[model samples]
Target: MPENMPGRINPEHITIVLNQPRYPENIGSGARAMRNMGFYNLIVVDPENFDLEKVEKLSTHAARDVVEKIQIFDNLQKALSPFNYVVGTTARLGGQRQVNSPSVMAEKLIPISKENNIAIVFGREDRGLSNEDIRLCHGLVNIPTADFSSLNLAQAVMVICYELFNAGTKKKHDFNPRLASCYELNGMYKDLKDVLIKISYINPENPDYWMNYIRKFFTRMNLRAREVGIIRGLIRQVNWYGQKMYKDGLDHKKNQEADL
Candidate 1:
């Protein structure tokens, strides 16, 4: 940990999202945990008959403001729309999911939170994140346990928040980079896919197969806004040139027809 960067990220920049939380007590305690670690923003998505009184009671005055100001959303995607970097927490994980421990994630998150809105999403009490829900997130976080891996909703929240707070308190470098937002990245990828399709670089029937690979490639780069803009510009140029060549070939064909 370097010492140059102090107070790099504010608590306001980080949001804790509980998706379809079954118990108000859990939500309350989760808020309490966040408050303990200096985080305020809380978003509840499709909660199950949550009781404000229960929340307030369990929060124990620590997170009264958080409980009162909690944002509610019907859809997970809409709930996460405002955030540029979204990380989903999961107990069971496999496949293409890249799950990082809380400590590792905390280090990566600190710098990004300084420049963009960050959301750390916790799933339901019964089951963890669905495949669809996980897909929306930019990354995954997993809390390691001994034999019994399953953790209570609030407990999981506390572990991750604690790591983030601990990481923030430590010495850090002045690593403020102008990274592209998720919205901008999505737009750039769309344009890239279009250009790739136009040039027959990717199969039209399953462009996402190639696009997912490309997305993974870019995610590692932590691409800056200017880098994304340059890539988009390059795609546009390629598309323009491809269109020109096609039009020129058509003109040549018409000329041959006229000569004959």
Candidate 2:
């Protein structure tokens, strides 16, 4: 709202990504947890356990907003595509990959959201996110536990949202609106992706090879709208340079042709 800012996306912009969640009750509980923690936007993708009407009942009073406004997507990436920043939530560490502990990641992101679109992703209630799914995120976050670590989807949402809420509130700056809008980041990604395609550096048939890691880095950084815009502008410049170089070469070739 202010000049070019997206108008407080932290409160209105946080979106929950539930990937292949298999329990209706967990979904409801997660929704309720989000509302209790002060986050409202919910996005469920390719869930295995879903009960349209039952979710509200399980949510009790906390999940009412989710029940009324829940949006469903066919895949996690599509759900994540629209977001500028994305973090993956998992219970199991799953191998030895570099990742930030849940609380640590929260500490990093709360301030970052002041400038970018943010999304927190929760895997299935049972198995958690696969190696690939975790790879898609900018950073990995999990609750500290003993040998076994498993968190209900709603419970996970609650913990993460609580951290974010607290982090935002304690800040010194005006928490009114610090980050970019959902649409701005979405458009920037689209523009950048198009540039990648133009350069033939990215295969449209398989964009994940690049988008995943990029998503993780940006999500972890919690970029601002202006930053995203700046990057998009840079991409445009690179593409223009590539075209100009191509045209100059063609002109030289034409001169040679005429001489022949």
lDDT of 1 by residue, 1-260 (tens): 24654544557789999999999999999999989988889999999968999989888887888888899999897887657788999988678878999998988887787777888999998898997788667889999999988899999999988988877545555567756776777789889999899889999999988888888888888777899899998988998999999999999999999999
The number of the candidate with the highest lDDT is 1
Which residue window of length 10 is worst by lDDT in model 2? 1-10
In model 1, residue pairs whose N, Cα or C atoms come closer than 3 Å (at least 3 residues apart or on different chains), thus clashing, are none
Clashes of 2: 7
Lowest-sum lDDT 10-residue window in model 1: 1-10
lDDT of 2 by residue, 210-247 (tens): 86666556655556678878988998899899899999
Which residue segments of model 2 deviate by more than 4 Å? 1-13, 81-84, 92-98, 112-117, 130-136, 165-222
